[model samples]
Target: MQKYSTILLVGVVVILAATLAGVLVFMKNNPAQERALLPLVEIAPMEPDSAKWGVNFPSQWNSLQKTETNNIDTAYAGSSAFSWLERDPRQVILFAGYPFSKDYNDDRGHMNALEDVRATKRLNLNDEDPKRTPATCYSCKSSNNPGLWEEMGMAEYDAMSFNEMTPNINNAIGCSNCHEAGTMRLIVTNPALNEALEAQGKDWTTFTRQEMRTVVCANCHVEYYFDGPGKYLTFPWTNGTRVDQIISYYEEEGFSDWTYPEAGTPMLKAQHPEYEFFTAGSTHYNAGVSCADCHMPYVRDGAAKYSSHDVHSPLINPEQACGQCHTDVNYVVGRVATIQEQVAVTKIAAEDALIDAINAIQLAAANPNADAALLDQARALHRKAQFMWDFLSAENSTGFHNPEYALKICAEATNLARQAQMLAAQSVNDPSLLTTGTYYTTP
Candidate 1:
């Protein structure tokens, strides 16, 4: 019994020593390697200089610089900037009373936001018209916005003229905008986004890590309009993110971007509503996919992996962007193209119907014997039709995010405009108003 006990004790001692030795080796080596892997430089809060943050995250910074390239072109639109009006003259007629008609262009990337705004003829910033553009224009253009918002306060900051606030915007969007200093954790920078989320009874901090991945981009990517006496940036999400819900919110607020030149109806201009559109029960979002999942897919660098920040079309890097879930690359690309084509077709059809409605209304306006009630009905229909069409049109995705929703929106626009046309014809006592005419060419 003593011999057996001695043997067991020896075995136990040997096992424990080996385990201890292994643990000691790991403790000595692992922490040093981990420290070495950490960011070399420290980032400061709201750092205006992206270059400083670049030092700590070279791969991400390097990738971000790729946005400067305007070579890539997709099926419907691309990074290469072009006059939106020239691409389709119908847009000019649609935005006839707004500044967008003056100089709207295809958005390139994050790098170009500031540069594009500066170069755009949208704002006549001469001393003659200092209020040509609002300070809110810089909201999405720079990472320096948060600091400016803090210093000037929301009301004062929003009320300042474009020139008065331009000096405060020193840096274009960068790491500081979407990340916390020191920790480098993702965070929501835009206060307006936070307020918007709060209004929906959502606490931004309560969002999971995966949700934050998309929420970071949602800060600037969603549709918004200037509101109140200060022209403060506000999301049209009081009712909901849906087309009709957003329209209802606008109607309740008595919001009008501009009156249609000929139709004389209030208009609702949609900014890019990608986040709202995609996250509103989209297949991708439902499947736990975030914008960063595709737009900023993880890439490996020897012993390290980091989210690539070359944020542009996911189609540009489908293997890394989409291959994780979608097996067939060609099938996915083909599917997106088909969806876009379908949406485009319906969009044009809707626009044609809307233009006819506008023409009919114009005829009614010119006619002395036009019925007031019928004219009012025509005006209301025009507002609804344009709101639907513009919601899809201004969205940067071109209906790839949610094709069914886009098509439905356009279909509703068409139906409403057709109804408006019939009413306008009755108002003006002209059956020709119900038929197709060269409306864009007329005025």
Candidate 2:
């Protein structure tokens, strides 16, 4: 009887072991289900129309569509497409010779990129003119870029006139602008950004997923210049992304977007440089926070939780945006307001200084008897001062990205402008160039 009971126990143990082994094998062969483990439809690479990609990600697409109509206003910036030129007329004189001075409206949002670019008064639609806008302007305005760039090469694509290239660009920013269709992972979709990263000896592929969130924004939100006759898009990160470093790089290349009218100083027009500003050793960045962390906070819908696709100011949704890191959301929002206001006021001071410098330089240039060498020195200083100021002015964040850095740059810019004005006066042996409040007193 004892031997029979022992035999039954041994048989049960053998059966359980075999079943466990089979379960382990099955689990190894079949992985657990994740968010849409298999696509209901296979998306083609570089699909420009977002609706096709929306088939796989309805929530993100639906959320993204809201940007088209959600034109909310914040204290400094929002999606209302307000004319920045009207809000700050100082920019008019600052950018006098550039197209931006004529028409500089705040961007409506990502969804309206194509429409806004088409409508901007700055665009010279005449294809026959050599100074007309090129297809390079479409670099950040369309989802169709990746495929077009792949087929045509960026050099050839940018070589075409904007009017000539308009037919090919049909979609505004979409999933393909920043994602891989095959894996649905964030990627460096802009070839210019890819090459810039390489120029810095950094590989975007080796970057971690979190890093990609911020770096991906660099695709469109960076300060770039059109290189050479091809009007090829290029980021000025070869020297380093700092404001001073960027000035050095531009000086080395002897590049200027346009010559400041009357002032005769070569000037740089800063494209929105949100990426460079935010990544320049900010507190949030050091804390491992990303641009998307504040701008694209995660929200829950039923059982699904995903980062909200309606990208905008964090002040628009402080609870979901600032509440994630800071315990006091309201306090943080208040801080942003205070910081932005301070920066705005300080920025105006810098602008005033720049105007004075331009005024002095203009006087000096008009004086043929003025020491040519001294006049050239004044022009160089004016160029550096104005570019530094524009870097902060065009950043779009109103200096909240890095308040200390912003103020530091502003102070430096003001000093440079004053020095430029003094040099201009010394060149002509006249103190008239040292006049202040020239803008207020003029016209």
Output the number of the TM-score-best candidate: 2
> TM-scores, in order shown?
0.91, 0.92
What are the lDDT scores of the predictions, listed in order?
Answer: 0.83, 0.89
Error of model 1, residue 140, in angstroms: 0.3
The ten-residue window of minimal lDDT in model 1 covers: 28-37
Candidate 1 local distance difference test against the native: 0.83
Residue 257 deviation, candidate 1, in Å? 0.7
Who wins the lDDT comparison? Answer: 2
- How large is the C-alpha RMSD of every model relative to the true structure? 4.0, 4.3
- Candidate 1 TM-score, true structure as reference: 0.91
Cα deviation of 357, candidate 2, in Å: 0.9
